[model samples]
Target: METPPQRNANMAQIFHRSTNFISRFSLFAGIFLAGLALTGVLGLARSPYFTRQNVTRSQPVQFSHKHHVGDDGIDCRYCHTSVETSATAGIPQTKTCMSCHSVLFNNVGYLEPIRESYRTDASIEWVKVHRLADYVYFNHSIHVSKGVGCSTCHGRVDQMPLMFQANTLLMQWCLDCHRNTEMALRPLDKVYDMAWRPAANQAEIGRQYKAERNIRNTSELSSCSTCHR
Candidate 1:
């Protein structure tokens, strides 16, 4: 049988080479797939849908911040009266709305809810858009008093027709400001000015304010207990 056509020595080498190639290829493919999965997860986490940024919820009354704050030039503290004095910025009560609407848009259909709530002396359960975990003990009064403008955290509420969560409000988000608070700081008098802009020498001014206020360093601001109580 022609000595069974003796198998070539190269056959073993070829088989080994093929197996090694497959092993390396598989390792690379696994790594690529794992990388893709990780990237996708991170992208989803930061997306608007996940962060609830600009997502408007249905409110009992479609109170437009754009109209009230932007058009009418109403100060933020006008409605959020407790922002500077309390840990939580208290929502405007029914009477608070009627204080203006009852005279301004009293006949408007949208103001009906306000009138009803006022007539009944019932509280309007306004849906909270920005909410942090209970474990996070945030003090609004402290932040407001520290020269941090409302727009720093709430974004341009004057432009938002329906209030939405402007910032991610994540721990990292809070730390970003706490670590470099100078960027967000404004004059105490301008805290309620939603359209407030920094001066040309804002950095220098911010440093001055930081020194004057004796603000804590990044190490303390980023500490676990800073937000987590």
Candidate 2:
């Protein structure tokens, strides 16, 4: 019943109104999400430390880093002793575990499963959480020589009930820590502090104590020559 001209005009007006409403809604939504994302990032950046990553690792024997490293006061170097002295802090051999188990495996609460594994003559399949490709070479001694501590790479291990690879441990991550003289190059005090805060004189103190403890050319921290021929 309406005139054709009037109908066309009405249709054009409706379409124009719809397009404007959609455009404005989209713009407002985009701005709101961007603002929210920026706020989250800024909040993260402002903190003294980043939020703890949401990760957990459970291993065979329920090996407790907290119990060993924190409660018993066993140093990381004791189990991973070779790290500071060798190219790799090689996994503790069965003998290493047996040494402790021989002494403590009888404790009813602690060694039940551990003894079971020993009885079976099967090594506990340790769930290695942190790993890199075979081609990437990392030397514990080199980092230790530079006064980097066990915790720097391992994260707050004393807090972990089970040992997981806490850091991303990517090549970039390695380079970042290795490159920062202000960070990696630190004092003898820095080498031991699992809970180090910070200091201005850290680098100078670290540099002063370049350990004369010669890393014996015994393949430690060396390349393929250490592992292969």
The candidate scoring highest on lDDT is 1
| CA deviation > 4 Å runs, candidate 1 | 1-20
What overall lDDT goes with each candidate model?
0.86, 0.65
Model 2 poorest 10 in a row by lDDT? 213-222
What's each prediction's TM-score?
Answer: 0.87, 0.61
Scored against the true structure, residue 58 in model 1 reaches a CA lDDT of 95
Per-residue CA lDDT of model 1 for 1-229, tens digit only, reads: 4555656745555466688899999999999999999999998988888889889999998889999899989888888899989999988777778787778867988778788888888777788899888999999998888899988889999999998999998777898888887887888899888889888888889888888888888798889988887
- Candidate number with greatest TM-score: 1
Error of 1 at 61 (Å): 1.3
Report the C-alpha lDDT of model 2 over 1-229, residue by residue, as the tens digit. 9655654554544466688889999999999999999998977753423423335556656788788777888777677868777888877766667677787756776566667777887777777666656866567787777667777778778888876666665444655543444445545556766787556876555445444433233234343444233
